[model samples]
Target chain A: MAVSDEQARDELGERLRKFVGRPAAVAGAGKDPVNAPMIRHWCEALGDTHPAYTGPDAIAPPTMLQVWTMGGLSGHPGRTGAYEELLGLLDAAGCTAVVATDCEQEYPRPLRPGDEVTFDTVIEEVSGRKTTRLGTGYFITTRTEVRVAGEPAGVHRFRVLKYAPAPHRPHEPRQQRRGPELHEPRRHQEPESRRRQEPAPSKPLRPRPVINRDNAGFWQGVAERRLLIQRCTACGTLRHPWLPGCNACGGLGWDTVEASGEGTVYSYVVVHHPPAPGFDPPYAVALVELAEGVRMVGNVVGVPYDEVRIGLPVRAGFRRVDEELTLPVFQALSSVTAVER
Target chain B: MRAGERLEPLEIPVTRTLIVAGAIASRDYQDVHHDPELARRKGAPDVFMNILTTNGLVGRYVTDHFGPKAVLRKVAIRLGAPNYPGDTMVLTGTVEEVDGDTAVVRVVGANGLGDHVTGTVTVTVPGANPEATP
Candidate 1:
């Protein structure tokens, strides 16, 4: 964990230069689609089940508060998310670019289940610094706006220090806010109009499969339930998402296949960091092996936050992620099946 | 394309006949959906498919009817029953409403027995970005 002062400063400067002034906005305005159990898991992990967030009225999760602040850059696939594509850009530039060495949060809004939120974020500041262990790192300041459909949710500020000695966790600051969820469905416009007028300029026409009626079914399935994999009968191999042909056997003909929900954990990471949308911090994310023998990517849910492991078995359940898609997800096995290795 | 004019119907045939083929789906991972015993412990009356893994089925259904030009903007649904291994369910959608640059539709999934979920879907077209004026 020991490194030079100048080394850290230069690293921070490089990442800041890449994200400081850019903006990202999602096209086709709508809600991020809230799931009730996700909110419950979030609350259980972070230990913040405010009545407003879980009440029958249902409000959006606070982390989902970050929907739209990433202005004008949705056009570029690399810029769809404020920080995600930036990491790729940094990686391409030859920087290891690990995320925040440390962070702190202050909640301005208490979310109720089912409430829609619109968000926008900005790099509040960026600077270089040396850590206690002589590790040099860069710090970034981010601000996010949380809103409901067209209303207000909360505002959050995050500090990210990257490429340096890991910092210690700080005590969480407690705050208060309230609301209700059990209401008649209200019309929503999650993607603020600004997204349409603000696509970050990028080169057009990079050849990729065009999604028309023939392929609309694939995208439509994602909005519902069922994970569709391309099966190559020629070699008995499974393929990735939206593949035109089988990569395994060079099979000219292939068919779509579905998975049985049960699976095993391949690997897992406990998110002790800031919570992501519809997710609370301290949740477990695992690469589960589906019963089909095909390893798949998905989130593990409905278990104690403190007891997740590498080989813990799990099963699949689902929730409405939005109006069009039902998320295929997993829950931990109970009793002895739930016992960790 | 005219408003509410559905070019085709999106259908996904969900069957457990699929063979496992990667690091994603493994052996100990087998439960009733793959290994019935494991499925029971996971709080299910039976083994089912992970919702995310099955996303491609619904996506293919929409693309089959609409052509590759459609960009799926949003999807929302609730789980009605378990999708088991070998059993098949059909996922379907029909364009319900279209305003200016957007089309509102309802998508449903059905198994051999009957309907699973009947929900609404909204998609944005070339110029349907704006819903109203401030």
Candidate 2:
């Protein structure tokens, strides 16, 4: 039995490798032009203020490179069948789940306004089966060469992992006791009595915040109920949403300051649709501008969702929603302390 | 990880519009990317960016620094943090190894919260000095 299993795996690996150089997507010219409106929309979405993206001499934000080639809602027609066949083969092997692993891009030049974009993508590599925290899977990487007016301008390499969800490990009792953190919120929305009778299916954890050497301090602050902002020690420029370097002075040295927990809602939105596992619907999320002049995003609780608005005074507080999580939230100040600033 | 082979930092603004627009452009209709309330309901503080957008930004970061002549051969990135609106993600990379025409680069993108992306990108910089590649 073991020999047959190994043989089957080896056969599949050989098949997947055959697709390495096959065209995954061939985009047509100006399928979506690199235009000012789209660029403006992109800039507005990203809150990027670099002057290079604006005005008559504006260059498309190099990050917007792939946006120009995106097939949008309709998708592109040049996608060949080989990519799908490989996926189908994986699916047949019970590796039906998929997640994007990573991607890399290379630019030969900057994309400018009025530059028409096109590209042909090739399946670059497929890795041997491997195990990850998520599950057992194979990584598939693709390379796309982007062009302007048929000239090579950039290359985009994307990768994804197709895997089978690992069988429930009996040792992982913690996972079996409750659904993933993402689905935890839905349990709250449901009545406690109902939850006791019918257990929901297990859900994966909510997408955890990315933690690495640069911003681990901030997450540690979140755990401590202290909102720590990165301050450039050299320039004294306080920045939020923690950054590695100071935008004002390009300084890399930094320290942290605990926010006073005081701020006003700079902007907000109320979400109602698309039911998710952990969150209750129609909650208000705000861009709370701290007194320190930096902005942070969090849920505004302790007040009706409809009441959240621009300039509402709020105080930072911690919400311990799950056993493993404690997030910083904003509570509207009482009418007495609430002054429109 | 060569001392002299460093990529100039690139700044990417993370705005609500960006989180939503990137989702729309990539045809990712997941509510956590566009609907703030739903994202919160799903246990996120706000609408977080999708991987596709992050992937695109990484591509941009590399190409922007390597000039138009750099050809990305492979990009392998892993998500580290949730990039919510109101943060600026800074991307930095360093060439780790160079072999003939191809050079390997290690990159990390950090935001106010934490490292948003950490990965390795491989590229073939045609005509790049042997010292830069080898």
Candidate 3:
């Protein structure tokens, strides 16, 4: 009497469930104590200049709750065999690929510099098999408790999907296949027309900027082909994106200063997936640090997305994206203008 | 911190270097975040930004708008669209509720694909006055 496919699945799930409630890691210690260098590295990578993350009284960015617990490329010493055995079972069951899908963090108390961090992890749950754009897979969730000196500091809940790759359709070229999915529940159905590669229905207009009372003047400036930066009347500090008050002095009074339009690419990213309406994919968006010492985000024109790099000199240019929308974009300058800052 | 008050929108360009750098910074060595070739083999067109990076971006958006003094108490985010290189994620937030110095902000980070992250962040701003006019 041969076992049916359903029976095999049930057995596999049963074995997987046994791992739940079991300890995945016991008393894992952070490779380093909470410190400033790691925080600085994190802030630089994300382009975050928030002051609270630095100085003598600095605390790690609350979002970095998970970074301290990571074992890096070497792997964690406290990881028990149970977690690996669980993964081995999944691989044996043909679920070889994995992708992290979700994360939820709560900071009960800030992890300050010099706080020794330790954590414990448990396999919280394992979902039943389900089919997704990537293929069939199981969702595995783990909950971790982080502590400093045996005092609760934070909690992190993480989830991932382990699945077998969906077999490719023989007729379609690999490049034409859909991009990686972020696991949105409602976008399950791919329109037949899209799958057939019909001329993408007429492009949609660019998304309009969300203008409020505080930032309306900035948009007005753009319409007139001038890039404006907000200056605090009290502290003389310059800011961007038009806030209600000055971050430096908390002053409510402010005025506008026209930008010199000259700037350098402080940082940048290339957008590749979930194609934007009205724009082609793989365009470069740069964080241009203006000559006046304020930073603003805009498209880096006159260069391919791949060629856009840090320290690239740029000059602000206003482009009327649509009848109602005029945006400030940066024109990449020639190497002759790329002076080292 | 009045209810229904909206924060200025923040536009973040999703770049290749950011994706790889963020992954490395957070110790997330997932191939989908750095190795494009391996990512493609695993069924991704190209490497995508990891969730940790998205979380950090969201945190930055909130604190940037609330001023540098604001401290985050909790950030519970759910991922939607994948933030692929060459895209932008516009982060917008609304003050849903406020009590003294603490406020709960409903944040949504939308990219070209759609909402990349949606969650509520609890933050406390020292000496925040709810009666102050905008």
**CA lDDT of each candidate?**
0.44, 0.68, 0.78
Candidate 1: tens digits of C-alpha lDDT, residues A1-341: 11222233354356556677555333323232455765555444323333445557765333333322222212222223665544433222222222222122223444555555465556666664423211224455655455556555555455443332221111211111111211111211011122234454432321232557445555455433446665777887875554555777677677777665667888887888774544546667778877776776666664555667778777654433322234455656642121100
Query: Chain A alone, model 2, TM-score?
Result: 0.48
Off by over 4 Å in 3: A1-9, A170-341, B130-134
List, residue by residue over A204-236, the lDDT tens digit for candidate 3. 778888989999999878766578999999999
Q: Count the backbone clashes (under 3 Å) in each candidate.
A: 88, 21, 10
Model 1 C-alpha lDDT per residue in residues B62-133, reported as the tens digit of each score: 434554344444443333333554556666667786666656666666654344444444454454436443
Q: Which 10 residues in a row give candidate 1 chain B its minimum summed lDDT?
A: B19-28
Candidate 2 segments exceeding 4 Å error = A1-8, A27-30, A167-341, B1-18, B25-48, B55-107, B110-115, B119-134
- List candidate 1 segments past 4 Å from native: A1-15, A24-32, A46-55, A58-110, A129-134, A164-341, B1-134
Best by lDDT: 3
Please give, for every candidate in the order listed, the TM-score of chain B alone compared with the true chain B.
0.64, 0.91, 0.94
| Candidates ranked, most accurate by TM-score first | 3, 2, 1
Q: lDDT-based ranking, best first?
A: 3, 2, 1
Q: Could you tell me the lDDT of residue A97 within candidate 3?
A: 64
